[model samples]
Target: MTNATAERPLHSVSVAGIVVREDGRVLVIQRADNGAWEPPGGILERNERPEEGVRREVAEETGVTVEVERLTGVYKNLTLGVIALVFRCRPVGGEERLSDESTDVRWLTPEEVEQSMKEVFSVRVADALDAAAPHVRSHDGERLIAAA
Candidate 1:
């Protein structure tokens, strides 16, 4: 058997966008499979750039066109080896519509998100809303943990 050190490690890179509207509302989606409401995002494709992947994922999941403003956070799912880059964006065009990935989409205020979403997910949106500095956080897919 190959030694662990010799085996190549695998990790998936993902991107998420927080699309804020003019009226101080953020766009979120209820995933079809799990009903969890979070920002629109997905794993980056092998041939795609980070910005392009984020834009495509948002459009596919929420049917909204966004102009990426700036990166707002970085998160890692430690158990899954998934690294996520979160960005702040503005809705440039398109309307909210259901897609294969998302079952529901809606605009929510910061208070609504804090009450509805889990801490890990809420932190992503919160970071975007604050727009102070980029947050780097780690999680076990559900709960955020203190970085080691």
Candidate 2:
């Protein structure tokens, strides 16, 4: 086997992202655990793919079905010990549903997301908005915020 494949160490595959609408609204979910607003997402389980993680998280948190369009960016937060993948997706279908993980879900405009400086966010959101280009991996979630 190639060294790359042989040396493929275990990784935490997680997925999450900014859900957007044709009206320029971005989906943000208020985390029930911390009351912080963020794009809906969660970690991928064993044998699970990042795409599945994003789809499952979005559905669980927002009751919205989403189709991941493209990989916007990848991030690793040293402070939180988390590695996350962020994608650009559109709402496919579902009622606005809330869960223990998310207290609320809303489609906010860019201005609204900026005003939401109440919490640190992923910059991948901004990058996704600015360009569909995929970003390299990061070691900090704070870097994800700058993507905005």
Candidate 3:
């Protein structure tokens, strides 16, 4: 490998699940680390597939088992170099409970999601809810900065 290639910064990939129930409520968690309300997810392990990572993260944070439907959005945190793959999923089993990573877990309506979450996170849920093709967006960790 070239010296330049070895010296380049590395980016981390994360997987998130926008778990939706039949009544249209979307699942969310209040992070224990920062108390921010967002979808349940975390850094993907190198050995796991994106879908598997999503299921594992959601279950770990929210105690909810999900059936991944499809990827709904790709979000990049420009400042952190973290690429998040967000998926639309259905809750197949399990119950809502908080873990060490999350302080609270709840199923919220789309409006509640917009009201409670930051723009970067709310957009992920909104995109998953929409029937259009998956969205590609970038954010500065708080607000959206670009779209494709």
Candidate 4:
């Protein structure tokens, strides 16, 4: 492989947990660096399984332990060049807490969430809810993202 290819972050498989509660509220977090409210997620650490990564990311970001139920959807973002997997999950323990990576965390209703998102989060949210054909989805969704 070329030096550039060797240096490239190896295509990694990461998982995100959509931990929504009974009240139709979805968990969201404001990242410390970007200040954007988004689902709690992170890249899978070396030798870690995707499901474990999902649980760990949720706990690390929100201080809430989550039980991953099932894989909801798999998506790729061409512009970002990352393969993302979303899962339906439920928090089993822990309380609301923020980590160094995040500045805030909260659960909001669908309508309430739309107004709060700084960018296109609805598509990701839809992938999380649309489980009928849950599988790998390509970055084609980017075509729908409004240009900045």
Candidate 2 residue-wise lDDT at 80? 70
The best candidate in terms of lDDT: 3
Instruction: Name the TM-score of candidate 4.
Output: 0.82
Off by over 4 Å in 2: 1-11, 117-122, 137-148
Error of 2 at 17 (Å): 2.8
Per-residue lDDT over 57-113 for candidate 4, one digit per residue giving the tens place of the 0 to 100 score? 999999989999888777676667768888888888999998999999999777767
| Candidate 3 Cα deviation (angstroms), residue 112 | 0.5
lDDT of 4 at 15: 75
Q: What tens digits encode model 3's per-residue C-alpha lDDT throughout 1-148?
A: 8999999998999999999999999999999999999999999999999999999999999989999999999999999999999999999999999899999999899999999999999999999999999999999998899555
lDDT (10s digit) by residue, model 2, range 1-148: 9999998755566788678989989998889898887888888887787888889889988999988888887777766767778889988899888898988888888878877634236465676787757875555544433433
lDDT of 1 by residue, 1-148 (tens): 5798679778999999999999999999999999999999999999998889889999999889999999999999999999999999999999899999999999999999998888889999989988588989999988999977
Q: Which of the two, 3 or 4, has more lDDT?
A: 3
TM-score per candidate:
0.93, 0.81, 0.96, 0.82
Whole-model lDDT, candidate 3?
0.96
Itemize residue pairs with steric clashes in candidate 3: none
lDDT of each: 0.92, 0.77, 0.96, 0.78
User: What's the TM for model 1?
Assistant: 0.93
Candidates 1 and 3, the one with greater TM-score: 3
- Candidate 1: residue 120 lDDT (0-100): 86
